[model samples]
Target: METFADLVRALDTNTKTNAKVAALADYFRSASDSDKVWTIAILSHRRPPRPVNTRLLRQWAAELAGIQPWLFEESYHIVGDLAETIALIVPPDPQNETPLGTLSDYLNAFADLKQQSEAQKKAYVFKHWPGMTYYQRFVFTKLFTGGFRIGISQKLMTRALSQATGIDEEILAYRLMGTWDPTSVSFKALVLEPQLEEQYSKPYPFYLAYPLEEAPEKLGPPSQWVMEHKWDGIRAQLIFRKKTLFIWSRGEELVTEQYPEFQVLADVLPEGTVLDGELLPFPGGRVGSFKDLQKRLGRKKVSRRLLDETPVILRAYDVLEWEGADLRNKPFHYRNQILNTLLEQLHDSGQRYPLDGSPALEIANWESAALERERSREKHSEGLMLKRKDAPYRVGRKKGDWWKWKVDPFTIDAVLTYAMRGHGRRTNLFTDYTFALWDENKSGERELVTFAKAYSGLTDAELRQIDAWIKKNTLERFGPVRSVTPHHVFEIAFEGIAFSKRHKSGVATRFPRILRWRKDKSPEEANSLSDLKLLIP
Candidate 1:
């Protein structure tokens, strides 16, 4: 227990990624098997269940430190963090306590006992309770369980591993996915071999994300670039390990049950393989709308109707794993060779894999110029991604490897027709404004095209001023939305303008947000029907 506390203290003081990784590696390498398991479990679980209506931990900390809660809250700004403030109040004392020296000692001790039986280790931990208080337990839980997620991130851990092991940070990142018990071969093995080839017998397509800084200014006009519509959907890694199928989202959530159809793909895919691609809704041989996918997310149980209506397809882009080999180190062109081979294999095996003629996939030769032309014609596409034929797989964002050339945002000046009371911090203000563009009639009279809405880009002072103006201008009132006189013109910016049969203007804006208020322009000076039509694609 003292050793665990010491580990926490050491970690608290060490902020550098390398130092933290070294400390963790050392702790795991030396700690008792029981202690190591506990640590891993705590870190994996991260946070405890929210205790039923207990006083806020900060309030208790303030009481113990002889300060008011408000004062402590204010002081948080000085310390720049909450955990540090609590640590400052509970300084460790040296009253003949058995101080644990180095983290490596702890980890080595723990790793040494990996061969021990599980029952024996359990019994050992049960018998080894060093006196711990409720407050101490709280602090310990926060540290070990990762509930105390502050000043640290998984990226930092990856960096630490790189520093400790003398491996490239990118290599470490590609392999590490937080702490896990090596004894649990199923989970730990997956982390140790995150490359798609080692884990899966079949090949999967993945987008090779390019760093913004590394993207070339001119890839020989848009013609050299292979453009594809960057869809807003879940990035999933599908694995058929043994007979069980697992679907892992980029967020690391196992969503196999949520998407059982993909599991059926295991019947066609070779066993012990992983594939990477976007998991998107496909209905009636066409990619379903993003709004259609919203119904499937976060649902633990899939309704029969939803399963039938919104069947998903894997939009394969890159192959990661193939036939128990880790191809992450292989260049993109080599991986593509494996990917193409696997696709042919799957098709021959009567398995489902998106191909050139498949309704779910749009595969073609890499052509940046042609893609730009296609993107211009298709408003749903966000941009194009470029991957080097021979770049090794890397973790996190790196330059010169992957590139995403997004389409420029579409902007238009629109009249502020309505305002609504905002939620959360802006509950008192009507900050959410509905804006419209002018739709001219043949008789020279203009009507409003209610196409966009914006709720951002305004400062607190601006919000307050707008709120006051909204209140003063008498107009029809709805429950939360208030109709206001069309006096203010705002420059609304958005990505992807799609023709919507359901909307009054036959068009809808994607990601519409306020860029700025055009205070100098009158409603008449705002964008006309022709301007809105120009942005149709």
Candidate 2:
């Protein structure tokens, strides 16, 4: 626990990526094998189920610290993080202190927590708190809650592992796929001695594109690039291996059951064919709106009526595997040809298979490409994607080959009506804010109706300025949220808009971000609810 605490401190304090990778690599090289497995599990969001609820932990911590429950509550609001607050308030007991147990020992001990009485659980928790340092306790409590979000990406994790084990990062990434399980298999077999059968269901890391920095024509002649519409749908990989159809989301989830309609692919596609594509809820040939597709998501099982109403199709963009050969190393034009042939097969099938080819954007120059991007809204696509015809598919977000040229987001000026303190270093500052649009009440007075909430796209300096404004203009306090004077106008931008019954304004916006602080405008000058309604299409 002490060593792990040091690792966390090093990781948390360092701002440089190299320093973080070094700290993680050092810990991976030196930590116990069992501890290493647990660390990997926790960092990768694979923690065990929470053994105890938070209310009891707070009560017990307050008693151990000899502080009143209200005092703990006050500190909790100010600190805004339970683990940090308890770690700060808990008193040290040097005389009664003992060496902290290993992480494996703690996890094994927690297995018996459900069987223990409330008093037994309290005693068991209190037994371990006193012996550990504050940071160690913070980590332990956070693990118990199972909400561990550190800054490490899978790419960085693989890089650190590569440094520690003398393995290439790319191979490590493939081994750490959708179906890789650390609990059931040893780390050695998972990374160093991987079995091909075990990895058959796993998805290769997706190759992402950077947003195009300059105009598309800056790259080269139009003949050198292959362009396609960037569909606003789930980025997924469809696998037909071992006579099974597995659809894996980009997040590494095996969501095969979500769209059982995909099962029909096993009838037409040959074994060992893997195609990368966007999953669109398009029946026949016409594509549905994003909202129509979202209804099919978040369901344990799709109803017959819902499935028929919003049938889905895969717009195949690239072919990763064909027959049995791994053609990822082939050029883009070659893989695209392979994808075309598969789509031809799907078309020949008498039954309407849910698969189609994303047509290439035909452009003579960069200026023409810009005009095509503006037409994305007409087709319900987000933007255009440009890929070099000669580049091989690569892992993760490598910057050279592919680029996304997205349309400018739809924007609206709205009034900031409510504010709240955010967690972490910004806990004392009101960074999270709810925005509202102007609506006319029956009384003939302009009213504010909440429509969207945003907390990002502002610099620290800008946040501090708004935080000061919110503190000075607070009209009422409803717990942590403050109803502030609605004077400040912010230009909110979003990818798309949809009519939603859940929202009070009868609408919802996708990927809302503060485009700019419209300091020049007044609350009355903000956009109207009716104006937002027109954007629902």
Candidate 3:
């Protein structure tokens, strides 16, 4: 536990990427194999379930520190993190202290907490708290809460592991994908000596594209690239291997049973076929809105009526594996040709397959591509995807090979109506805000109705200025949140908008952020609910 805590401190304090990788590599080289395995599991967001409730831990810590529960609560609110608050409030007992246990020992004991009584759990926590140092205690509490993070990406970790073990980073990335049991698999078998059969159901690390900032003409001639409409649906992989089928999301979640209509591919698609695609809700052979896809997603059991309403199709874009061989090393144009041919063959067999190749746009140059991007919203797509024809499928987020050029977001001028303290360093400042649109009451009176909440896209100076304004303009306090005088106006930009019965304003916006502080505008000049309704295409 102490060693792991040292690694966490080293990682948290470092701002340079190279320094972080070196620190992680040094730890990987020196730590025990079991500790290395557990560290990798934690960094990859595969930690064990939280052992005890945080409320109980807070109360117990208050008692141990001889402080009142209210004082602890206040400290927690001010600190913005429970783990850090408890670590600071409680002092270590030198006389009764024992050496801290290993990382694996701590996690194994926590995993057994489900069988233990509440008293037993309290005793276990009390037994360990006295021996640890401040940072160790913080890490311990964080692990117990299952919220231990130190800003390590899987790619960085893989690179560090490769440096430590003299193995290729890409191979390590592939081995780390999917739902591997951290407790059961040894580090040697999991990474160094991987078995191909065990990874039959595992997904490949998704290839992500950076947002294209400059004009498309900067990317050179149009003949060297292929353009495909960027669909606004779930990014998924359809894998059929060894007579078994699996659908894995980009987050590495196994969502096979969610859309069982695609399970028929197990028999139809040849063994060892894996296609990367976007899962879309295409009702009546026409692309449905993302809300229609959400209805299918929220269901654990796919009812007949739900299936009939939101029939899904896997719009395959790239082929990763074909005919029991990996084809990721091949050029994308070559792989795309194979993908199109296979889908054509499947369709010609007179079988209704829930698959289709993503169509490529015909363009003479960048100007034509930009014109096509303008029509993305009408086709229910996000924007355009530009892939180099000669590029091979790469792991994680790499630049140069692919780019996502999205359409301009829909914007609205809204009034800031509420504010709240944000987490981490912003805890002392009201950086989070709720924006509202003008709405008409049944009595024909105009009133403010909250339609969106945003906490990002402002400079630090702007945030501090708004924090001061929020403090001076607070009208009412509802726990952590403060109702502010609705005077400030902000232009909120969002990716998409949809009519939602759940929202009070009868609408919801996707990825809404403060585009700019509209100091020139007044609350009376803000956009109305009807204006937002006009945006819900």
Candidate 4:
């Protein structure tokens, strides 16, 4: 636990990627194999169900620390993190021995708390908190709360592990994908062992593209890039190997049973065939909006009505593996050609594969490509994906080879209606804001109706200024949130808009953020709800 805590502190303090990788590599080489496995599990968001809830932890902590509950709550708000708050309040015992528990040891013990009584849980926490130092307590509390997020990226972690174990990073990344119980799988078998049959079900690390901020001409000639519509749907991998089908999301979740519509592909696609594509709700021979796809997401079991209503098709863009051969090392154009040919052959053979090849747009040059990108929203696509024709499909995000040239976001002028304190470093500042559009009630009077909440896109200076204004202009307090006087107007930018019954404004906007402070406009000049509804495609 101490070693793991030190590693966490080191990772938090280091800003450079190489330094972080070096620190993690050292820990990977020195820590026990079991601890290393647990570290990987925690880093990859595979932590076990939280053994204790925040409310219970707060109560127990306040009682044990000899502080009033109000004081503890106030301290928690100031600290902005529950783990750090508890760590600070709890004093260490002088007579206690140093904790020698490994990361696995503590995690396993916490997992056992699921069956224990409340008194037993309190006794267990009380027994351990005093003995540990602040750093150990912080890590322990984070694991207990299941909020153990750090500054480590999966790529960096994989790189560090590769450095420590002398394994290929790409191979290590692929091995780390898919669901595996950390408690049951040893580090040797999980990372160091020879590839097992389980590799058949594992999905490769997804290749992500950086957003194209520059003009399309900056990427050179259109002939050098393969242009495909950037479909606003789930990026996924379809794998058929060893007579079984697996569908993995870009987040590495194995969602094989979620969408059984693609099960027929397993029977038709040759063994060991793998495809990288978008799982789009392509009903009525057209790609549906993201809202349509959301209807079937996260279902443990898909119903017949859902299958009929929001049918999905894997719009394959690239083939990673074909007939047991790894095709990722092949040039993308070659791989895409093979994929198109395979799909065409499958269709001509009367195999009803619910799959479609992503069609490349016919653009003569950069100007034509830019014109095509402008029509992305018309096709319900976010933008165009430009991939180098000769580039290999590399693991993780790499620049210069692939880029997503997205259409400009929908922008609207709106009024700030509410403010809330942010977490982490901005805990003292009202950095989060809820913007609203003008709406008319039955009485025919205009009122600012809350529409979207934005936490980013404001500079530090602007954030502090707004925080001060919010403090002076607060109308009412609703716990941590404050209803602020709607004197400020700002331009809100979003990716898409959809009519929603769940929201008070009868609308929801995707990825809303502050574009800029529209101080020149009055509150009454802000856009209205009716105008917002016009954006719903």
Candidate 5:
């Protein structure tokens, strides 16, 4: 326990990746099996379930801190984060309690317990929580129950692991995707497994995300690029391990049951292989809109009709594993060769897994003259992605290896038709807006398509001015939204547009923002349904 406390002290002192990883690795290497299991449970239990009511939460907070509920509530507003606020007000007893440690230790410890029994684990955890306060318990609950999110990210964790183990970050990341029991098996056992052969060929494309600061021009000519439509879909890593299909989203949620269509791919694609690609809905032989995908996203079960209507397809861009070979360390060009070969083999096998070789489906090598000519014509494609053939797979945004060249946005003059009160900082202001496009066929009839609901992109003066207008010009009042007359014409800009049946205008916009206010344009001159249609893919 004292050793664990010392480890926490080391971790909290410097939040550097290397330090965190080393502290975690050392703790795991030294701690007993019982201590390692309990530590995992403690870390996993950091978040408690949200109370049914604020009154209950307030009471809990007050009791935990030995303060009145009213006083706690008053202080909560100033502190923002409730857990941190309570921790500050009622500091934990240093004599008996254990402080929070590095993330690497928690992760490694949890990884170790992958083979432990539930009853034994629960008993181990309960035996360790004596003399802890309710606030400490709250923190413990958060850590153990998988809600302990903080400033740390998985990328940072991977970086720390790389530094500690002297392994390549990319290799570590790929291995982390696999299931391993740290308690039963050593880290070396997890990494040194022989690569298995791929049974059926499948397209597993890797993506190259750009950094926030680097622009497209810095990467050189567009012809040297392999341009593909960057679809706004779920980033999925498809795995066919031990005869079962496992589809892991970017959020690390297991979504195999949600997308049953890919089960066929699981049966056909080679076993013991992992593929990374986008999971998108294709309805009526077309790529379904983002709005369409949103309908299926939240659903836990899919009806036969819904599944038939909105089928999903994996837009394979890169191959991570093939025939049990870890191709992630291989350069993009070499991996691409393996990917193309697999696609051809799958097509030749007459497989119905949507792994056919098609020009539109594959994004490799762009023509300079053709790209510029077709730039305006490609509606769904947000931009061109350029990747160096020999670049390794990196976790976060990396420069030089990849670049995204998006086309200029399509703007539309839309009228502000509705407003709603914003949350948090803009709680008092009517910042949420619903803009409308002109319905040319009907007189004074404008279809409200959610053009932009911006609580941002407005100056303080502009916000105040708009707030005043929203209060005055509100025609009718709903619970949270206020109907307004179509008087203000604002130029709305968006990166991509898609045809959506759910929306009023049968369309949805991505990343819409206020480019400028076109006060001079009348409601009659505002962009119409046809104009938005041209922007759809």
Candidate 6:
């Protein structure tokens, strides 16, 4: 536990990726195999099902600390974190020769806490509290509270592990993917063991694109690039391995069960075929708005009506694997040749469904391509994807080879109606704001109606100025939320808009951010709800 706590502290203090990787590598070297597995699980968002409730921890903490509950609550708010506040307030363990426990020991003991009675829990906490060091107590409290965010990502962990074990980072990444239970698998089997060639549903890391900042002419001839519409949908990989179909999101979540419509592709796509594409919601052969797909995102099970409403379409942009061979290292044109051939084979076999292959743009030059990019939104595309014809599909974000030339975002002036304090670092500041547009009811007058909530895109100085203004202009307070006088209007920029029945404004905007403070406009001068609805595609 002490070693784990020390590692956590070291990780938190370090900002550089290399330094953090070194610290993780060092911990992996000394820690027991079991402890290492648990650490991986915890950092990968697989924390043990919280054995203790938050209320119990707070009550027990305040009771043991000899402080009022109100005092503890105040401290918690000021600190902006529950776990850290309890760690700070609690008295240190007694000065004695009590040896600390191992990481596995702590995990095992916490599971026992669930079965114990309230009095037994208090007794157990008291017994354990006095034996642990300060760092151990802090980590223990974090376990009790349920979130141990220490600035480490799963990607970073895999990179560090690759360094420690002399394994290829890509192989290590694939091994660590999916829902692997740490408690069931040993560290050696999970990491060091040789994997089966046909692991079946394993996904290759996604190749990402950087936004094109310069003029398109700088890239030379248009013939050098394979241009395709970047559809506004979920980035997914369709895998047909071992005579089965598996759909994985860009985040590596297995979403095969959620969208059952894609299962038919198993019969069409041959074995050992893998496609990197966008999972678009297309109804009546036309692209559905992003708002239509949000209804099915986190559902454990999708309904029949939803399947009919938003039929899933796989827009195959790139093919990573074909005919049981890894074609990621091949040039873009070669891969597309195979991809087009596969699509044609499926079509002629009478097994073709809604899966569509992307075609290269017919633009003659960079200037013409730019004009085509401007028409992206009209065609329900987020942007234009310009991939080098000779480039290979590499892992993660690499510069120069691929670029997403997205259209300018839709912007509108909206008044700030409500303000709320942000979490973590900006907890003391009113950084989050709910903006609204004037909506005319059956009557002649227009009323302010909530539209979008934006927390980012404002500079530090602008945020502080707004925070001060929010404090002075607050009209009413509802707990953490405050109704501010709607005098300030800000230009809100968004990617797309869609009609929504859930929102009061009857429209929802995607990725709304503060473009700039529109001090020139009043609340009355801001765009109306009807105007916002007009932008819905």
Best by TM-score: 4
**TM-score on alpha carbons, each prediction:** 0.55, 0.85, 0.84, 0.87, 0.60, 0.86
Model 3 TM: 0.84
Clashing pairs in 2: none
Off by over 4 Å in 6: 51-71, 93-101, 108-134, 197-205, 241-248, 252-263, 283-285, 295-311, 324-331, 352-354, 365-368, 390-395, 423-425, 440-445, 501-504
Q: Give the Cα lDDT of each candidate.
A: 0.60, 0.83, 0.89, 0.89, 0.61, 0.84
Q: Which 10-residue span in candidate 4 carries the lowest summed lDDT?
A: 194-203
Instruction: Tell me model 3's lDDT, rounded to 2 decimals.
Output: 0.89
* Superposition TM-score, candidate 4 onto the true structure: 0.87
lDDT of 6 at 90: 82
lDDT over C-alpha atoms for residue 254 of model 6: 72
Task: Note the residue pairs that clash in candidate 6.
Answer: none
Of models 3 and 5, which has the larger lDDT?
Answer: 3
- Tens-digit lDDT track for model 2 on 117-195? 9988888878777766889888777767667666787668779989999987756766665444444656776667855
Q: Please give the distance, in angstroms, between residue 318's alpha carbon in candidate 1 and its true position after superposition.
A: 1.2
Model 3 error, position 303 (Å): 8.0
- RMSD of each predicted structure: 11.1, 3.6, 3.8, 3.3, 8.8, 3.5
lDDT of 1 by residue, 80-135 (tens): 44445555653344352444433224334445534566555443322221223334
lDDT of 5 by residue, 374-473 (tens): 5633434445456666677666566777665556677888888898776546766777788887554456655655545544566768877888999899
Give the Å shift of residue 483 in candidate 4: 2.0
Distance from true position, residue 65, model 1, in Å?
A: 28
Candidate 5 residue spans exceeding 4 A from truth: 1-208, 211-217, 221-225, 284-286, 356-379, 440-452, 471-480, 483-485, 496-502, 520-524, 529-537
| Displacement of the residue 524 alpha carbon in candidate 5, Å | 4.9
